[model samples]
Target: MSTVVAQTEEPEFDLVEAALALCGGDAHATITALLDELRFVRGQLALSEAGMSVGFTRGWKPRFEIEGDT
Candidate 1:
């Protein structure tokens, strides 16, 4: 039986395709920026609607609430 050789062709990076990809990338970045803005705006809106404010001291709070060792 003859052994088959694998072809090693260089991957094509079309400039037009790459440019289109960058446009999509820009759109994705814009969406992410808008999402972050929305998160901040929605958080502010929620706080305003609830009419609640919280103050924090310059320290870290413990996340571990150990009831007992199992």
Candidate 2:
């Protein structure tokens, strides 16, 4: 009989726990600051994974411009 080795996979990071770590025991501050940072980081990572195709650019301009009648 041959024995097979089992491989173990690591668990994913919990946003709440990471946020708590950043909070340093302050509930309100943690919620606002940590959450904001988490959101920004998540957005950046998502965009990078998507090849950054959906965001805005500085040089983009509308083809038609509206003018007020005098």
Candidate 3:
């Protein structure tokens, strides 16, 4: 008899979490920041086809260093 195996998937960077991390783990800050960033990215997507695509679903990381870092 053969046994079935399950596979595990790696976690992708969450933008909301990253924003919260940037804002010192503040939920309000994360929501506000992510909303603004999302708007800007949506605008870019609408403006041009070559602008590339972005989504909150997954596959992203912090582009800048968090605050209070040396």
Candidate 4:
């Protein structure tokens, strides 16, 4: 039996490398920065959801609602 191997092409720009370069190659710093940005985005989403009118949203609700969240 013969098996065929698949090869993947590398991207022109590496996002992981770019992120490391921006954080001076500190892995911890890169992770912390990403987490902070995620928190900020989630907060913004929550605010937007809170402001949305039930009528405007047509009674639509988030599929997953976290406990203790308004």
Which candidate number would show the highest lDDT if scored against the true structure?
Answer: 4
lDDT of 2 by residue, 1-70 (tens): 9999999998998977787777776789887996687778777766655553334544443322246884
Model 1 per-residue lDDT at 39: 82
Clashing pairs in 4: none
| Among all candidates shown, the one with the greatest TM-score | 4
Q: What is the lDDT of residue 20 in candidate 4?
A: 91
Q: How do the residues 1-70 of candidate 1 rate in per-residue lDDT, one tens digit apiece?
A: 9999999999987865565465575866656666787788777766654553343423433322346797
- Candidate 4 at residue 25, lDDT? 100
Better of 3 and 4 by TM-score: 4
- Candidate 2 vs 4: which has more TM-score: 4
Worst 10 residues of 1 by lDDT: 55-64
**TM-score of structure candidate 3:** 0.44
Candidates sorted by lDDT, descending order?
A: 4, 3, 2, 1
User: Scored by CA lDDT, what does every candidate get?
Assistant: 0.61, 0.68, 0.69, 0.85
Off by over 4 Å in 1: 1-25, 52-70
Candidate 1, after superposition: displacement of residue 27 in Å? 0.8
Q: Give the runs in model 2 whose Cα sits over 4 Å from its true position.
A: 1-6, 34-70
> What are the models' TM-scores?
0.37, 0.35, 0.44, 0.60
| lDDT, candidate 4, 1-70, per-residue tens | 9999899997699999999999999999999999898788788878878889889899985433477857
